[model samples]
Target: MTRLGDGVRLAVGTLTAVPVPAPRQIDRAVAGVAMALGPFAALPLAAAAGLIVLGGAAIGLPAPAVAALALGAVALGSRGLHLDGLADTADGLGASYDRAKALDVMRRGDSGPTGIATLVLVLLVQFGALTGAISAGHGAAAAVVAVLCGRCVLSLCCAKGVPSARPEGLGATVAQSVPRAVAALVFVVAAGLATLAPGLPWWRGLLAVAVGYAAAALVLARCVQRIGGITGDVLGGCVEAAVAGALLATA
Candidate 1:
C-alpha cells in the first residue's frame, strides 16, 4: 500500500506540473505501477480545464475564447510535455524514413518546419473541435473526456507487446510495463467514464473513445514501423493526437 502511494505520487509528479514531492527511489516496478495509473494522474489536469470552461461559460464568454482558455489551462497543468513530444515526433518523422536518422532528429532539441507545421495543425484542430463542443453545451464534459483519453493512451503504449525504441530513458523504463489485460481494463473504464460525461449520450462518448483508440493505434503502428519501437516522443504524440481525435468525435 505504501508502494502504491509512492507510485501514484510519482505519476502525479512526472505527468503534471503539480507540486507533489518525488519518491526517494523510482525503479522499473514503480514506473510500471505509475504508468498503470496514468489516467488517474490526469484528473487534476482535466478538472482544471473543465473549471475554466465552466467558468467561462457562466460569464457569457464566447465558445472559442472559453475553449482556448481551457486548452491553455490543460497545457499549463501538464507542463506541455505531450506537446513537446508531438513536436519531436513530427520532426523525427519528417526528417527521414531511416530509423537511425529519425531517432537522431528527434533527440535534437530543436523544432523544424515539419514539427512546427504539425503542432499548428493539431492545435488548430483541437481548438476548433473544443469550441464546437462548448457551443453545443458540452464544454466541461468534452474537456474531461478528451484529457482522460489522452492520458489513457500512455498505458496502451506501454502495454506488453510494445517495444522501447531505446535501452534507456522513460520510454525504455515503462515499455511493455503494462499487461495487455490491464490495458484493456483501463480502456474499458475510460470509456465508461466518458459515457457519464455531462451533455452527451452514452453512445457518443463510446464513439469518442473508439476514435481515440484508433488515433493512438495509428500513431503507435507508424512509430513502431519507422523508429523500430516506441519512444518518449511517440508516446507524447499519441496523447495529443488522441485528445484531438476524442474532442473531434464528440463535436
Candidate 2:
C-alpha cells in the first residue's frame, strides 16, 4: 500500500472497531497523516450516529432513548476505546501525587473508584446534552457534530509541540506528529462548515465549535499539568469531553 493508504488504514484501524490492515511501517509522517485524517477515518461511526438520530426522530422515539442509542452505537463502533481512555486517565489523575505511580495506575486494565465515577459523570452529561439537542429539532446535526467532535480533536492533541508522557506505545508514535498549521486548518474547516447544519444559526455553529475545542484544550492542559504530558488515555478523555461540549452548545 502507498503511504497515504497506510495512514488511512492506521487511522481507521486504531480509532474504530472496523478492521483494516495495519500499516507495514510507522513513522512520524505516517502517524501525522493518521491523526490529521482521524475525523474522516471515523466517518462510518459518525454517519451511523446521524442516521440513528434521523431514524429515531422519524419514528417519534423518546429523545433520551434515541440519544442513548446513538451514543451506544458510537461506543461500540469504537470498541469503547475513548471511554476506556477516559476511565484510565481519570484513575491516573486520582491515583497519586507521584507521576510514576499515576502512570502505573493508568497502565492497569482495571478501573478504580475514580475511573468508574468519572465514566458515570461523563456518560450522564453526554446523554443529557444530546437528548436536549435532539429535542430542540437539531437531532441529526447534533449527532453528527458531536461524533465528529470526538475525532476532530485528535489533530489538535497530536499537533507539534505536544509531548508524549511515555517513550513507547501508541501515544508516542502519534504524539507531536501533526503540524500546528495543519491542525489549525482542519479545525477551521470543520467549524466553518457547521453553518450548513439544518436550522442551526451560523453563529451558534461557530460557537459550538469553539466551545467543543475549548473543552478539549482544558482537558489537555490538566493532563499536561498532572502527567507532564499526554498519554493515549489522555487523548481519549479529550475526545469525550469535546463531544459533550459540542452537544451542550448545540442544545
TM-score of each: 0.98, 0.97
lDDT by residue (165-232, candidate 2, tens digit) is: 89987889999999999999989988988777776888777777788899999999888888878888
RMSD, each candidate, Å? Answer: 1.0, 1.1
Residue 158 displacement (Å), model 2 = 0.6
Candidate 1: residue 183 Cα off by (Å):
0.4
Residue-by-residue lDDT tens digits, candidate 1, 1-251 = 76688789889998899898887678767777888898899999999888999999999999999999999888988888889999999999989988899999999858899999999999999999999999999988888999999999888999999999988878998889888898999899999988988888998898888898889889899999889788888898999999999999988
Which segments of model 2 are wrong by more than 4 Å?
A: none
Model 1 off-target regions past 4 Å?
none
Q: Distance (Å) between predicted and true CA of 17, model 2?
A: 1.2
Score each candidate by Cα lDDT.
0.89, 0.89
